[model samples]
Target: MPAVTVANPLALPRVPEPNPLTGTERPVVSVTTAPKGFEGEGFPVRRAFAGVDLRALDPFVHMDQMGEVEYAPGEPKGTPWHPHRGFETVTYMIDGEMAHSDSHGGGGLIGGGDTQWMTAGSGILHIETPPEHLVASGGLFHGIQLWVNLPRARKFAVPRYQDITSDRVALLSSADGGALVRVIAGEVGGHAGPGSTYTPITLVHATLAPGATLTLPWRPDFNALVYALGGAGTAGAERRPLRAGQLAVYGPGGALTVAADPKQDSRTTALDVFILGGEPIREPVAMYGPFVMNSRTELAQAFEDYQAGRLGSIPAAHAEVRAATPDAD
Candidate 1:
């Protein structure tokens, strides 16, 4: 796709001191494209990061679509009760409200600028419903749902949840006044996010201004990828336009550098992107439907548990949408 010029680039907040690391090893970087998400029947959700399957990215499995969509009044806009195992789902809302409820007694409504971090350890049932504002206004909805895999040791760990408002999360500014970086999982600069994670990873949501440029020091041991929510930019040798919902996975490098396309003079448009990096697990992964495990035997056991009504019920009544019937995509 051709580069889409940004009208206004958002300015970055002031940069803080760099993160202190004991070693000189830098994170590996790569640029990759996100494929369309949610292809199965009934579960008609669109995907952006893990297009074909969750295993493609190994340690980090998937990232769903990001953009604004209008849901008609009284329309059911949400995912019904689904099962997940061996991974965590992180939902960041940019607009609209989502009422989420799960099997672990975790339930709440997350509005614009809100986030939900769910660790579907072992197994759990969960669902999300659009709030009145979304249903009434043909609700404008935009956000990202990312999937992070658990290491072999943590695959069967107990489930957990963390609901955070935008204000509660740590925000980091760029030194060059290029962008505002929201640290969701790992440390950026001297600040770290409140969300507790099992792996040593970093997820940064950045907003950049038209002429701004930002560089992040990284550790080479970790694998990293970037997903653009809006605008266009060049990372190293790759010049790419990041439209809403598209993602770019960067190759292994010790640093990440991003700059707004200088030719695009529109100052009203800003660049919104996600920086995700973590240590890669050199282990086997077996995933079927919603459950992921280290082995097919474990996956089968999960299915058996669900069928035997062992997965347990969601703590509260989740706003229910019709259950999506399964099918081969």
Candidate 2:
């Protein structure tokens, strides 16, 4: 839970409390526990979007809560080089280090509290793994990887990358200074985070002290979802029980609420949650392994292109073969 923190939340800007009379508080639609799964090179993950309807997720396609596990030396793992298209991959490191390299010359080391945003617009090839030193020493590795769906209009946009550090994120506090909210993208309470997105969305990481409640003003149009990273809490005005690895989807409203339990487990002193939402794409979704397109024909074309070495090649620095990203739309 070392994503980001302040010793004194009271000194930060506070989120205005929603008006009880005028603001409509979003109600919890459903709470689904994420099923555990292994991803990449056999690393454990919690499938955050499991059991949730894709229409509810809209602009979002997939999400994974990567290990809260401590890896012993030589146990660290990551994905091999892979191809992606028609979407963006957002990797947020919460308590570990990850090294990223791509054929487009977009590569960097993301430490705790940092984020790597890669748009596989038309297509791209990339690999993500634990840093050499981290792998050798064995350490804590925890993070989130989210796949955001690109609208049909932008599916062929040029691939781009952005590195967003924790310091660049917008920080705010609850009116009572009981919660610390980190806005990683989009606007919240007039505060905008540094991460740029093609979709109209908001990403927030909030931590609440025991017995604290945070009420946030949300856009009526953007769908809302809250996923608990750790600790216990209640979501929405009706107070649906929520805990780690659980995701709560909300109904339409002008605001939402999350309250931390008065008592927490010995491992965690507070409640941590990841809140995200976006304007629904509302288009037919045709997705397959590694590609998200609007039609099966397009998906087949993507696979053919990838097999023909059109997506991209492993950077020469990492592999013997160096190929430029193909100019295709």
Candidate 3:
């Protein structure tokens, strides 16, 4: 078993009593519920934060929480080969296993607690599916995939992938053993996640015990939001109670604070949430299903290129992600 270490409390920078910097006082602004949308063939998900203001949410546009649903024997479903352009897709697994296959011959399987980050720069075709082993036996599958919009200048960059395993992710803990945060990107407690982003962003998956509190600072220039995934908790200065399935879209502020409901039984209480935000890319965004570009003309070109197979294809042998059963695999 891989060892999970607790981060040193002194390693993490303490939040200033009042931000010493000018124009940087973190506050609780507006909180929005992430509307649910049945996106992939497999899960019931919610868009934790919603808005179209490109400047306010520059590098970020879409976020979705994949099913924490358990699939019965032979009932698992997933997304087939699809096309994407002008953005990056990040898949973080919480339970079960999911595999990634792409037209450029890039593929990887991230089991529970792992992450896979893919960039469909100019364009790429890919499929994310449950491994054959799980699909065959039928077990629980859960995960989250986030679509990060790219700046025009970098939209045409080459497609790539970053496979980050759970063992490589950094863990930050509170001095009292109350809060534990998994840093997927950005630094926490003097350590960082393995993701390499084109756009600077902060992404942390945190779990707090009953009454546990954790505060972290962010780039004052970036926008931020928090999505509750488990139990109940409060965020920002307002202390609004955010339970599971609630997404808090915060207004401009500096640092963010969150704590789990302390009154609950500590043994069973768990508050899970994802804190994410990034610098905005203020530019014209023309989006069609699966294609995002600066203008309608570019979007049209993307569709045409994909139809013409310009984006490439996944090898027949490696395209499908069949379950990796002991004997069959």
Q: Assess candidate 2 and give its TM-score to the true structure.
A: 0.96
TM-score of each: 0.82, 0.96, 0.87
Each model's lDDT comes to: 0.66, 0.89, 0.74
In model 2, the runs with Cα more than 4 Å from the true position are: 19-22, 320-329
For model 3, residues 79-185, the per-residue Cα lDDT tens digits are 76778889998888887888777887778888877889888898887777778888899977667788888888899999998888888887766656577778888
Clashing residue pairs for model 3: 26-254, 58-280, 58-281, 131-323, 132-322, 132-323, 133-323, 133-324
Runs in model 3 with CA error above 4 Å?
1-25, 51-55, 263-268, 318-329
Go through the candidates in order and give the clash count of each.
32, 0, 8
lDDT value, residue 117 of candidate 3: 89
Q: Residue 217 CA error for candidate 2 (Å)?
A: 0.5
Per residue, candidate 1 scores C-alpha lDDT tens digits across 178-258 of 677777677765578777888778888777777677677665667667777667776543454545445555656566666
What lDDT, from 0 to 1, does candidate 3 have?
Answer: 0.74
Candidate order (lDDT)? 2, 3, 1
Winner on TM-score between 1 and 2 is 2
Compared to the true structure, candidate 3 yields what TM-score?
A: 0.87
